[model samples]
Target: MGRRRRRKPKWVPERAIVGELDRRGRAVVAAGEDGRPREAHVDGALPGESIEYLRCDREGPVDAARTLEVLEPAPDRVAARCPHYGVCGGCSLMHMDPDAQVAFKQATLLADFASHGVEPERVLPALRGPTWRYRRRARLGAKLVPGKGKVVVGFREKDRRFIADLSTCEILAGPAQGPLADDPGRLISALSELIGSLSIAARTPQIEVSAGDRELALVLRVLDPPSAEDLDRLRAFAAQYELRIFLQPKGLDTVAPLETGRELLHYGLPDFEVELGFRPTDFVQINAPLNRAMIARVVELLELEADHRVLDLFCGLGNFSLALARRAAQVVGVEGDAALVERAQANAAANAMTNLSFEQRDLYKEPGAFEWPGGPFDRVLLDPPRSGAAGIVEHFEAIAAPRVVYVACSPETLARDAATLCSRHGYRLAAAGVMDMFPHTAHVESIALFER
Candidate 1:
């Protein structure tokens, strides 16, 4: 008996072109289907590019079309450097020019600021670094596809949760297995080959990749334990590449080195004469050069005086706090993660930073819950996550630091928190700008200084 064939999706306007880019950098396509103007977003498409995509029968909150073909590209559109551009969800702005990408991110940040009824007194130039191979940390997805008889390792698809078949990645830092140069081609392929040879390839769900100045570590998340042969292969693979290999059976605390003599993942800020140690699961800035530049900018903006006391909130592993300690008289770094707080303390001690102190406090909770800190600080630095520093913004009087610098990963949340600070805390948005922490993606990392 013959089986029913799959039906094609009901895509509209067989001939359509993207008119412009939206605030989020998405390509916006306006089409008049059945004489009614309809709008939909085309993925992997640049503005002024003609494209073809699948449109389902019913539209979603934001109608997203996939499998796009750029018939006539935009003037500013450039060929994607990554071979797995469209399939891999790691990057969405590779087709757009790098300078344009930075501008788009800046515009996104500024628009958010304007929407929240706040504006920066001065707009700083976008902070940028190398356009390629800047990502030093990533959690790659792993899956064993049926019939393929091998493991597929890469980022998930742009529209789906399935892993993209990736042989190499351009944005990711190359794992230096031995003495050879950092080659992107060998990194993903070697990881794929290693996992495919394992008995528990299907049971492995993730590979947490992180690279420090001299160390590149991979932590394999295993659902089930591997056999004796699997351990031999893993150990050999680790030794061959001279890569730090770790295994995680369940929780993050369970992650351990596969072999002995594993050193703590380390990086250094030469400008500040500071070195930091971190675990593979710890949150560090993806772009090292850009991070150093950012810390410099933050220090310059704060105009840290030798007699001033500074507060660094959400200071993970003392990345900024360490740098600030080099300039400020006293620096107090607070983070919610106890583990990171401990790491920060160790880093401060290792650097012989007597002026810096590390503390653990959930900055997201009520500010009155804790005995806060010795504040009325001269300067305050907030490096919050995507949720922003909403909880503490209300009780700004507790710290009431005259000068506050906020480093944010989310522009919308930054704008929201800026509104709270300006309206209630008597702070003015002094200066603001973005940093290309993750290029070729919509992720915007911005820094703002507030003055009272």
Candidate 2:
């Protein structure tokens, strides 16, 4: 018996809806004659701007939408520098002026604090640096579309799974500095056939970019081994652009340089007289200048003394541990990744720092499972991931650190942790402010000082 013919789903009509911007910089409107208030999060929107958006779909209690037109643009609204601004998902908030972007970030932090019924006693001046060409690391998507007859390399499209076709990236390939920076499209196009061949077999899907002060490394995630001819082509391309190419067949541990005797990538903190060597895939700050500034700020806020001992948690590769050790009598760093711990230890030794030490432990698990030095710690520094440091915060009293400084990338998680440290542990939020670690985007990197 023949099955009944299936009908295609009707397309949802696009409606022009207007709304005011909410704290998140999204155009928001309550339930009204226009549409459901919860349904509108208009992209490319700024506060105080009346924008027209096409309702797309419902996302939980909120409505997802796309900005159609700005009937009355906000005063701070400016032209986005990147040609791929609206279409590329890599950056948002670029429409707003750079200064306004920082202000919005500060406001977001304050609003998050308010939601938790807490506020910082003082807010520090926002820290900022070069907004463009500041990104030192990026994971670019690589795909081959036969229909397009080329390889596409860049970020994914906004709110979509498909990659956005990009010739160059302003963020990573700073201001046409070199062949790698000026025309990344040429690099991808040159290697398109090889990449496309592997991609068709579901072998290589992504390329990670990590640039140091002098060197740039591209780690290609390959699902299968490449032929000798492919290696020759890759080597030639690498030599042409002065790029260090590493291929990963399965895991991060499997990543190895195409040729032996490759140079190691490193960045220097001249102020602290410290240089840190790292693998391309390691977790280093994408913005180099901001990182130097951030380390300085953290050290200043901690008020480190030669006699004071510091504890650095989530200390990836001893970026903070080595820096703190330079000032403090002793700095102990703990991280979950054993490889990072080894790297941190090696970094300390390379800098000839005998006072700093690092340990490997799953901080989220039972603290007692791993032995930690009994601490009458004078101060503590935390640079946790987005999940926040709930595990560490829960055991603050046990550590008995008089002062605590938290560096966070997520305001929501920071707010949650702040509440716990204050209400549950009798710590006061002394000073907090946003850092422009990621500009042209909604990401908020913040630091908060807490005292018991």
lDDT leader: 1
Q: What is candidate 1's local distance difference test score?
A: 0.85
On a 0 to 1 TM-score scale, where does candidate 2 land against the true structure? 0.91
Write out the backbone clash pairs for model 1.
177-241
* TM-scores for the candidates: 0.93, 0.91
In the range 75-135, model 1's lDDT, one tens digit per residue, is 7788899889977889988988999899889989999999999999999988989898888
Tens-digit lDDT track for model 2 on 1-452? 99997653333534443455554456665565555445567777766666666666666777666777787877898998878888988887789899988988998899899899889999999999888778888887887676888777778888678888876566764223456665444454445554765423246788888888777888898877887777877887788787888998888889899878773688888888989989989999989889999999999999999999998989999988888988999898989999899889888888998998788888889863445674768999989999998877876777767799999999999999999899989999999999999988888999999997
Q: Could you tell me the lDDT of residue 9 within candidate 1?
A: 55
Error in Å for residue 130 of model 2: 1.1
* True-vs-predicted CA distance for residue 115, candidate 2, Å: 1.5
- RMSD to native, candidate 1: 3.5
